[model samples]
Structure formats: C-alpha cells, structure tokens
Target: MNDLGKLEDLPADYRAELTSHNLVPLWPSLRGVLPPGKPRPNTRATFWAYNTIKPLLLKAGELTPIEKAERRVLVLANPGHGLEKMQASAAMYLGMQLLLPGEWAPSHRHTPNAVRMIVEGEGAYTTVDGEKCPMSRGDLILTPTGLWHEHGHDGDQPVVWLDVLDLPLVYYMEASYHINGERQTVQPGRGDRQYARGGMLPTPVFERSAKTYPMLRYPWAEARAALLTMGEDMPQQEAVQLTYVNPETGEDAENILGFYALMLRPGQSLRLPARSPACVFHVIEGGADITVEDQAFSLTEADTCCAPGYTAVTLKNRHADKPTFVFMADESPLHRKLGVYENRG
Candidate 1:
C-alpha cells in the first residue's frame, strides 16, 4: 500500500534519489493525473447580460479615446476558466469593443484568428488587407490571422461589436505576434462587391498565400433570409442554421476557428449532441433557456452564454411568438485536427 501518511517515514536519500531522477511520485499525484473516470471541468452555464454592462461600456467610451486605448475593449471573463485573464471560456477569448464616430482603431494584425459580431449601431467598418468591409448589427467580420485590419466608425451612434478570438490557442502555442501598420484607411474601391444574398459569395478571389477565407463581411440581411428559408426546408426542431465558410474552398473560414448562427422558432426546444470543442453563444434575438448539463441560463438579446466541451446542451424558446437567434463561435477545428472531436445525437 502506497500510504501518503508514511511519506515522511521514507528515507531522505531515497526521496532525494527520486527527485534527482526527475520522477513524480505516483501516490502523491495519481488522482490528478488520472481521475477515476471522465474529466469534468469546473465550468457551469454562465451568462452575461448586455443591459447590465451597457452603461459601463458607454462610460468606457467617454473616458478613453481610440488612439490612446489602441482598442477599447472589456474582456468577458469566464469565472470557471480561473481567476487569470479569462475570456469567454478556457480556449477562447471574448470582448466587447466600442468604436466612436470619427475615431479609428489603428491598423494592426496578430497571429491568432479573430471575428467580430456586431451587437449594436451601424456605419462602422473594418479594413482587412486593403479591403474596407462595412459593419452593421448582426454582421460577422473576420480578422484572419496575419491580416492587416483597422476599425473606424462613421455613423452617428457608437459602434459596438463582440470580439471573439482564439487567443488561448495562440498563448498555448506561444506564437502570438502583432504588427502595427501606418495606414488606418483602405484605398477606396478596394472592396466594392455588393453583399450577396442566399448563400453566395460576392467575390470568389482565393489567394494562394492566404491563411484564411478571402471574404471579410457577412451581412445580416443575407443571413436572416437564408435562415428563414432553411427553417422552412429543414426539420422544425432545428428550424434554421448556417455556418460561415470559406468562399474559395467552401470549407470552414479557418482551420482553428469556426462561426455559426442558429434560430429556433417559438415554443421550440432542441437538444444539441455533445461535441469535443466548447463554444460561447451570443443571443442575437428573442430569449432562450439554455441548459448545459444540469445548469441552465436564461439568455436574452445582447446576452451571452457558454457550453463547455463535450457537455450536452439544450436550447429552448418558450415565447408565444418570435424566434430566437444565436451566434456561436467554437474551437472545434483544433479538436477535429487532433482526431479527438466527436458529435452524436
């Protein structure tokens, strides 16, 4: 019997020999290294109400300038992810960025892939690699890894967007890099294609050297129309859904990150099968009761919730009318690459 109580009785030289050989005593650390069964993270169904934080965001905008702050963002930390600089969950980072009219977040690019889901306001745009893509509510703007991008708001109201990034993966790989650029604006007529509707890419330009999808902006009008059409054609249980994909190859936008939007009709509920990668869902419209494992989160518009990896989730909308829309981002691609990703009904 390897009794921990007898650890002190062991000879000092013997312990020294174990340490000198760089051996970790199994008795003292076995439980942690190998749990009895499946691993369970400390995370629970967590929610962040936008109404509760809106004033704080406004205050932040009033106190800080885009030039000084570089980017005025409030990171949404997952308490279960630990006390450190937690964002969204353990493997992803989420932040709400505010861009005021007449101000610009200077051009910069980093190794980690990023996406912005517009929460409120309009007439703001992000320039990616010389292409200016306008931003509006419900638009998804991709800031692919290593691409030069800057954000500016020209509208009357402040532009607010939720920033999601695979920053944890970047830190884990220690491959993070940021390069500042001289120009904040892209040349006019660089990205002049009209926003396509009904699952079409306005431009089919594929760069041989590109690391991400060439299309930068996915407008709300197109998404909403397609989703409604999908609702009518697909099973009523999962009414509507769409995944942002690469126009060049018709695959995921990026290998390390994925973005998807879904809609559930009134009084509808669907249980999502478990998968290896965790995800954070931003409530875009209506309200839903999102249950993860045994815990539940009642989420409303502008609110966000999370579902840890491999945890069973069910989304329910009990409203008499109005469908619920959710935008979610996940790190499933990494797990899939490692051959550890799994999903089933």
Candidate 2:
C-alpha cells in the first residue's frame, strides 16, 4: 500500500488556515487511529504488591481521617496511562481503600459501577441500598452504578479492600458523578444467602423482585468451595474457573465488567489465549507467577496486576501442594456489548 500524504507537505498558509478553522487533515493521523493488525493499548502490564500497599494504606488511615478525606484510598495508577489519571486500564480504575475501626464512609450513590474485593480485615461491612454485606477476606461486594452504598467498620482493627470501578469509562463518557445520601436503614435479608445454591433461584409466585441488582455481595467462601469442587470433579480441565454471574439471568455480575474466580491446581501452569479485552487479576489465596506478553509479575496474597488487551497471559501456581486462587475482572462485557469482543487463540 502507498504511504499516506503528510500534513507537512501542505503549504504553510493552507496548514495555518486549517488549524485556524479546526479542520486539520486526517491523512497524517489516519493510521494512528486505525492501525493495521491490532490496537496499541496504553494499558501496560502492571503489578501492585499487597505487602508494599498494605503499609502505605495503613499509614494513610493514620494520616487522613475518614470524615476529612471522605474515602481514604490510594489509587493503583498504571504508569502507562500516567499516574495522575488514576487508571489501571482504559476502562477500569483500581484503588486500595482503608477503613479504620469506628470509621464510616458516608452514604453516596455514583454513576460508575464498582465492586470491592476484601483484601484483609474483619467486622467491616458495606451497606448497599439497604443490604448490610459483611466484609470478610476475599468477599466481593458490588456498589453498582447509581446505587447508594456506604462503609462502616465495627471491629477493633483496620479493614482494607480493593476498589475496582468503571470510573474511567464513565468519566470519559462525561457521565460520572455521585450524590450524597442519608444513612440507610438496614434491610432484613441477605442476597448471598437467598441465592445461595446453584441451579435454583427464588421464584416469586406473584411478581419478581423489583430490585435490579438482586445479589450485591458474592461471598468468597462459596466461590472458593466451588473452585475446589470443580477441580475435584473435572480433573482434566486445564482452567478450573467460575464466572461471577447473576443466578437469575446467568449473566456477568455487573454490566460493564466481567468478574471471575480462577483456580490453578498445584504445580499447574495455564496459558490464556490473547483476547481483545484488558484484564485485572487479584490474588485471593496462595501465590502465582504471571507473565503478560514480555512482562512478568510474582503475585502473592492480596496482590493485584493488570494486563493489556490482545496479549496472551500465563499463570503458574507457585505452590507445589496447595492451589492458587485468583479473582479477575475484565472488559469482556463492554467489548461484547460493543460487538468488538475477540479471542485470538
């Protein structure tokens, strides 16, 4: 193919006029926006060690009070996108949030969808809408778009969790904002318990539950147990993974991102095919060595990493006797919805 014309080839006066009229030529920049083969993603292979983040997060708790800072969080910003952007990927934002004992993150609802992966702590709970979801190590609690949510810690120690949100995407679309609300009245039932068992849902005889988000909190216990059981039952499967989905509709838990729990058997090394969606991996239990493209990361408990789209990734369980469990969030749902999802095996 012939090379496109350059803007420099044009006369100075013509170029000046084009710039003055905000009508620059596209030939010079066409290939940049529509590059051949695949996209050149700004989201790079980045890792955040929990050991390193924990101390900083604890110090942040001491330095800034909840009342003053509102939500004390240390954003896990990717260098590829610049630190000030506070983005882990093109569409995902990640931060480590701390809630000390007796601290309360006031009630507010936002336009971006978010979920909390409890890293460490006890006696901390998040109330979404009206459900008081307890915070335990490895639990995932959703504070979906426009849903009232707040955090409260009753235990005697500090509590911390990984905050994953679709703020970047929403902000880019100019639809990111939140509204403050009064303290919520605790509800009666828990969604995790109501939708506990698989292959069955609460069938309403009269009318279905009006709530758009039926299950807001996904307990790690159930997910871990399911992975262990799957490993035993399907011993031949290379990737013993389970998607966190709505039991009623059998879809991804949230609309913009897909959440999953993956288990690697002892001494297992699994290779994931190159797919057209950026993904974030958080270690829920055990240790694993991960390689994204040419970059490698050694992740332990509570560690988090992000891999760019259209790149193959490899995960290996570091333990010889115990399995490694990882929680993953990806842009697959958004890609599929936009008709651009791909799996280039």
Candidate 3:
C-alpha cells in the first residue's frame, strides 16, 4: 500500500472549483471508508451501573411529572458516540425510563422497534396493541415498530425499566417519527399463554392471527426456567443460551435487533468469538464480570454494558454457588440483513 495524497496537495483553484460544484475527490479518503482488516468502529465498550442510574432516575421523576415529560428517561449514551447522540451502540439506543405510581404514559406508536427489560417494581404494565403485559423484574416487553404502546402503574413505588430501541438506525435513515393515538381497548387473550410451551403453538384452525406481532411480552420466569432446564440437560454445553424468537416463524423476536437470554454456570467463564455486530448485555440475575478486549466491566444485577463489533468478549459468573443470567441484545439481524454478518473465531 502507498500513502494517499492529502486534499491540501491539490491546487487551490481546483479545490475551489470542486467546492463550488459540490464535488469532492475520494482518493484522499478512500482508505478511511474502506479501512483494511476490520471496521474502525466508533462504538466503544461502555457500562451503565443500575445503582448509579436509579438515584438520578428517581430525581427525574420528582422533577418532572408524567404529563409534562411524557416519558421520563435518562439515556445511557456511549461517550465514543458523544453523549448528546443518546446511543448505546452504532444502531442501538438505550435509556432508563421511570414510571411513577398512578401515572400513565400516553398511547403512541413510533417507527423504531423497542423492548423494555423491566428492572424493578411491580403493578406496572405496558399495553402494546391492546395486550396488557404486566411488568416484572427481568421481563421483556416489546413495542415493535408502528405499534401503539403505553405505560400505566398501580403500584406504590417508582417502576424503572431499561428501554432498548433501534432508534439510531431508523433516525439515521430518516424514518423515525411517532403518532399519538387514543387509549387502546384491552384485548382478550395473552400471547404468552397461547404459545406457552416449546414445540407447541396455538392451532390457528379457525383463521390465522392477523396480528403482525403475536407475542409482545416475554416473561422472565419462562426464560429463566428454560435456561436452568437446559443447563441441567446439557451440562457439557459451554453457553446455556436461548434466543427470543417469534414462535410462529422461529425467527428473531424483532426485525432489526436480536434478543437472547444467556446463563453462566457457577464459576464459569465463557468467551464469545469476535463477531461483526455490536452487542449489549444486561445482568438479569446474579453478578458477572464482562471483558471486552482491554475494557472490563463488573456488572451486578440490573447493570448493563455494550461491546463494539469485531471484539471478542468474555463473561464470568462472579458467584461460585449460583448461576448468572444475562439478557443480551445485538445488531446481528440487521447485519445479516445487510449481508455483513461474520464471526471471526
């Protein structure tokens, strides 16, 4: 490879003429856009401690009412992308949302796909397209793109949940917008109950479900139990993991991002291969030490972290007597859709 010529090396009049016509040369910046070996990602390894976020979130609740703020949230912005951008990774947006008791977040639908990982509190529920999904610690509630969703709480304390969304990508593509709507009429059946067990689905004998999203909420109890059962059944497996997928098609739960639950055995350390998609990890139960290349984050329950693409990550269960459960979200589906997914193990 040879050193590329700098833009300043070109004649001043030629540069002026090019600027006048809104034209620019690519040779000087070619290697930058087409970097060798791997991508020079701007997404860095970042961590957000739940303990630190909770206090600020409570203060936010006290400072602003639900009617005034609509959705009171504190974004877990990565410093690499600039805090103002409100992005956890290149394509993912993360925020800690606080909903106080007796409050309701009005109904609205947006273009970006989103999921809520409940961190704490009870008696809070999210109604997505009319299905009322109760909020429990570690539950995952989906508010997929263009689906009207709202939050309501009947509990005494403040309810906080980690909000993960594909907003950065959608906003970058200029398709990010929301439409307000009236309160939805609560539907009759819950999807989780209909598609409860593995290898079985509600027989759509009468007619196929017209709903684009059959299941909006994935209870943590089911996922945790599945991980425990798998751990016992397949003790030799390195990673006891389960993907959150659409039961009907056996595909990822949402289109742009992939969601999963991972379990680490007592005193176990698992190394994930370097893959070409940024990943976000949240501790659902127990503590774990996450190492992303040279950066290390000690994550307790409810804590979250992000790792950039093409970086090998290692996770270790800090507890020696119990298993550690983690919830992960990644850009794999989007990468595969763009035909750039890879695992460089």
Best by lDDT: 3
Off by more than 4 A, model 1: 1-27, 184-212, 235-239
How do all the candidates rank in terms of lDDT, highest first? 3, 2, 1
Per-candidate clash tally: 0, 0, 0
Write down the lDDT of every candidate, Cα atoms only: 0.80, 0.95, 0.96
| Candidate order by decreasing TM-score | 3, 2, 1
- Model 2: which residue pairs collide? none
Our tally of clashes for model 2 stands at 0
Who is ahead in TM-score, 1 or 2? 2
Cα lDDT tens digits, model 3, 30-58, are: 88999988999999999999999999999
Model 1, 37-101: lDDT tens digits are 44565555577889877889989988887778999988888888764766666568888989888
- Any runs in candidate 2 off by more than 4 Å, and if so which? none
Model 3 accuracy (lDDT, Cα): 0.96
Candidate 1 local Cα displacement, residue 68, angstroms: 2.0
Range of the 10 consecutive residues with the lowest summed lDDT in candidate 1: 190-199
Residues 75-131 of candidate 2 have per-residue lDDT tens digits of: 999999999999999999999999999989999999999999999989999999999
